[model samples]
Target: MNQQQFSSSHIPGLDRFWAVIPAGGVGTRLWPLSRAAAPKFLHDLTGSGQTLIRATYDRLHPLAGNNIMVVTGQAHRDAVCDQLSGVAEENFILEPEPKDSAAAIGVAAAVLFEQDPEAIMGSFAADQVIGPDDVFRTAVAEAIATAVTNKIVTIGIKPTYPSTGFGYIQKGEKLEIEAAPSAFKVDKFVEKPQADVAQRYVDSGQHFWNAGMFVAPVRLLLQHLQSNEPELFEGVTAIARARVAGDVTEPMAEIWPTLPKTSIDYAVAEPAAEAGDVAVIPGDFLWDDVGDFAAIARLNPAADESGVTVIGETPRVYADDANGVVVTDTSRVIALIGVENIVVVDTGDALLVTTTEHAQSVKQAVESIKAHGDDDVL
Candidate 1:
């Protein structure tokens, strides 16, 4: 994963703008459907005929053209390459192991900075489902515009509910940047709150859902990384430098596993906000993390006859008065009768049956399986 893999010439309309997709995470909540070898990003959770990561690449292609880089685990190398075939082999920033978003995204910043010092990179999660391509691109345009001013900008989704699952971002005064009129100074970053506290924050009309989409000059991002976590910064920078020297195999194997495991929020965003060096651009578009089976049900349209949400390729499904999600990957006909808010996931080696009310606890089942030495299904 080095700059030498692709042409250095910038795309006409998207010069200096690089879109980095961080495609890590096993999505344990998704369990059987999403495995360590093939995470949620590799599946079409929305049943839209395209995988999540593929959709993400399509969404950002217009904004970045060929200036796209994906940071992912080495285990997913072949799968990611197949999905993102348009992306160059050198553009794929392969991580030796899971070290969290900081290392995943920091290495991308370092690589882009080494290749193009003036590069403004935007890191978007590869597993997120966002819609109305025009709206998302517009929001990203504003984020890029704000990032040009040397501020670390994040695209904040307008909260639709007081969700305890996602973090909240408090916005301060509106920024008057001509290119980004809807931008605002970030007041602070808040962790996921309790139900009551989340309600208050949402009612106050001052908070936005933290979607973890960051846009900043690669140099500025590295500078912040150096200031907050010098050891981690040194590790990623060394990898990037190695890439510049025409090889990253030695450095990646030696330094990657040793990098500190931390998200970009704690490594850079939160502190940058405290120092008044962060900004937020309102993301006025449909967005979903597709975190669990509940999200899967929400994303897929219900079957007309049975009112059930069915995903994956199945021979037949006979449902009578059933309402919920059913993810199948077998030839057997799934017949559900009088089930309410029930979730059924049938795979080759696993079968999960639960209700929507207990969707969040599906990860616990995965944990239990691990404890019982059942790693094959996992």
Candidate 2:
């Protein structure tokens, strides 16, 4: 994909648009800091004292032109408000219940459509970090342009490593247009693969990381949802109609629980890929979803040895450790000795100790905590 093929008609009035940020996930892998009540998106992991949601909002504000919509569970409304106090109150779409991305994006699409049927909406994850704002803006502009003429347009990150943690997108035939230089007709979408398979994908040069960033016209999105996922579309449309009628808060809460819990990828993207209605734009910005501890470790400043400690308010003491991660609260001192490839996270009420290789199983650890009726720890 290149830049010349995309014309102004492809992304009409992109500068005047609203951005949808889905912040409803319980980041189980990053527990105990990322608890069910307060996910990773609300935490200040970067040590720069800014929450992830704040950083993402700041990064997208320029292109969104001060219009932003955040979709989150009702349980997280206060935190979402606290983090995004700068945004308008009406812009926050608090889900009455957790219905996953399919419902969340559907609701957002309905809201955007009501505002402007032709409006271009950029859907994003609250946990991702993309650098070089110019690159992101350019790619998003191209996506918006493509989305005007296409059903759905997604930003595909140029893979930097053979990472098995993310899904991949296979680029198909190029479009014969000068305005859309970086856009391609998507051939297929692949889920996370094994190490060998991921390596092959990386070597193929035809694959790109599915960044989960999307852009589309509000009417187009609703049409696709109505055609592909009638249940989700109907639920969200009812919510929108209820909001327009009166008493939005009560009806939203009552209707959300009845919706299905499915991801947008499974409900829409994959189906669109199979139906040949999706397109991909090569993303040039440095991006990271910050999905796990390993990704965090990689983003942290390089250490002389193999280990790195992320110190919060609490001081961390380390000795005889290699390739280990130690996270602690601000008030206590965490001491580590003779540990390698280990992760030690000390919350005020709970502690998690696991090997780096088993970090992905932290969700299981949360389940154990739940089994013990220690919801406070979680």
Candidate 3:
């Protein structure tokens, strides 16, 4: 993992760069805490003062400046705007429905292409927690430089472990681009593998976790989309043209909800990789999608010898000899005594009590709640 690292001052920021944040996911894994209306990205999961999206913005502001656009569902438009007053009203790209990453990022790409035909945009998740801000920014700067070559570039996170929860990107020979010395050809993009298979991938020392952060020229991205998915490409292009014309309301309403449900990986990345049109830069910084309770616990500074991580502003949690976990989102007092390795999440409406081992099953609880017709809690 001896990838090149550069100081933030050394990395050049492109004026044509734009950051497209696709912010629409319930994060059902962090149930009770993460709701459909207010998902994980809207919350300060890191216990940092800023919300996840805000933190993401802060991290990218140095690289992309005010050239940022958030692509979110119509339902979340107000929240996204309220959370990001620094961004202009026109910068927000509200989708009519959730059509997954391809549509969301594609629309952003289309709009950026309209603004600047050669715009280089990086699509970063609104909810990821990076290990070091500098390393992340440095990797992105290099990715942007690499993207200028008209190739799809992604930050290939050096796999810390055999993580079954994340997709893996296999790297090929090193790219000889002087501007992006650490860049490499993407051999393949593999889906989430079984535990044993994940271990084998890690043991081989040729795989990197797919960080879901993609950087490329807008034209190149749309060209790939048009080549692999004409229908989707046409839909986004039409919407983008309307946006550029300043009358997207009617066309977007008619076009967005009908787009197919597909992730960027399946829709473009895989095909581009197959065509030898993708590049990956090794990223050694620690990155976490904060997918589950285990990942949540890892971010808690309070997870001490007793193992307790209390979230929220004024959560009244008292742990006497409690050893496991206690998370509260409300003002009500939660007392945990002599409990070890157990997770207690008390939202105002719903409460989740489970063990750390079964934390991944929290999504099942959300489904059970839905089955019980309790959408308000969700």
lDDT tens per residue, model 3, 1-378: 112343334443366889888898889989888887888899888778888998888887767778889998888888888788888889999887667899999999999888889888899999999868878877887898788777899999888789898999999999887667899999999999999999999999899999899998888889889988899999999999999998999999999988887889988899999999899999988889988777877777574554578777787877877755566768898888887777888887888898878888999988988999988898
- Give the Cα lDDT of each candidate: 0.89, 0.79, 0.85
Model 3 misplaced regions, further than 4 Å: 1-13, 303-305
lDDT of 2 by residue, 1-378 (tens): 234422344456565467899998888889987877888898877666888898888877766756899998889999889899888988888876667888989899898777677787889999887777667878887777677675488899989889889999999987654556778989999999998999998899899999888787778777778888898899899888777676687778777888888888887888787788888989988998877776666666535564665646655555565556667775666666767766778887888888778888888878887998988777
Order the candidates by lDDT, highest first — what do you get? 1, 3, 2
TM-score rank, highest first? 1, 3, 2
- Cα deviation in Å at residue 182, candidate 3? 0.7
Report lDDT (Cα) of residue 325, candidate 2. Answer: 69
Candidate 1 off by > 4 Å: 1-14
Error of 3 at 255 (Å): 0.7
Scored by TM-score, the top model is 1
CA-only RMSD, every prediction: 4.2, 3.0, 2.8
Show where candidate 2 strays beyond 4 Å.
1-11, 302-306
Q: For residue 106, give model 3's deviation from the true position in Å.
A: 0.5
